[model samples]
Target: MRILLTGSVVATCAFMLFTSGRTLAHDYKLGPLAINHPWSRATPGGSKTGSGYLRVANTGAEPDRLTGGSSPLAERITVHASSTDNEVARMRPVVGGLGLTPGQTVELKPGGAYHLMFEGLRAPLKANDKVPATLTFEKAGSVEVVFDVAAMGAGEGAAKHDGMAPGMHQNGPFQ
Candidate 1:
């Protein structure tokens, strides 16, 4: 009986690892921009919106801006900035676009300053799902990449998911 239980546990663990599409890190390049590890968290049922995160580095002499992006999963994708002021957390759309200067690196991670908001989601994103997206830039034009969906609340600096609705706050993971 003990051996059977152990085997079952092992099998469950394997299943989870297989279901989580976060085992491999992905990267992309457009012009002089290098995007690393573009990913998103799994969304709950009936969620109309979700979030995306990644790291971007500018390796050229000229500066560029991340103008916008697109994905089939959402009708519109926009960049937003999250900040805390007077103990109040707020999120707002970033006007114009996000800029990356020469030799500069910007990270769009959970609990970070910037992120991509997916609005008007057509369907729920499940674990192991890959969401194809195109990131447009002022100088880089655009590049297609796949966003590996991780478990809900599963991301770098992501807090354990507590069943909060999809949104961003200063103190917790993006729900």
Candidate 2:
């Protein structure tokens, strides 16, 4: 009985750590699609928004589309495409969602051209924290995922979070 108790305790501890977003890495799957490295940057207090980034690959012969998703951390999540033109930052909601052709992979990263927007955050996201969210796809339906929070300024060229980690400005870099 004592040995069984110890095993249960250890298992509980590991589960807590992983679920709480303290683990080093995480991954998820929805049928033939592979969801890898879902992540987000910490937000400041009073900020109603945040951002999420990840890579999705469609290994199946059938193509898929990332429509949108939601999270308890925010009012809703939207997939968006952002770009810089002549020193100006421009972002537009992804229309018809993002397409993932067969055997194709796409990365939504900070300071990159694509990303997820978490609007109306319930509260600020602190570094090393994790946010729970979901991704809705046209083909695979929906899958629950966790966003590993980084230090608001993580990665080679992370976004800025003065307010909501918009990482966008009329001028200058999104970094």
Task: Give all TM-scores, in the order shown.
Answer: 0.75, 0.75
**C-alpha RMSD values across all candidates:** 9.2, 10.7
Q: Where in model 1 is the C-alpha error above 4 Å?
A: 1-25, 157-175
Residue-wise C-alpha lDDT for candidate 2, range 86-109, written one tens digit per residue:
999998899989999998888899
State each model's CA lDDT, in order. Answer: 0.78, 0.77
Candidate 2, poorest ten consecutive residues by summed lDDT: 166-175
**Off by more than 4 A, model 2:** 1-25, 156-175
User: Which pairs clash (backbone N, Cα, C closer than 3 Å) in model 1?
Assistant: 166-175
Give the winner by lDDT: 1
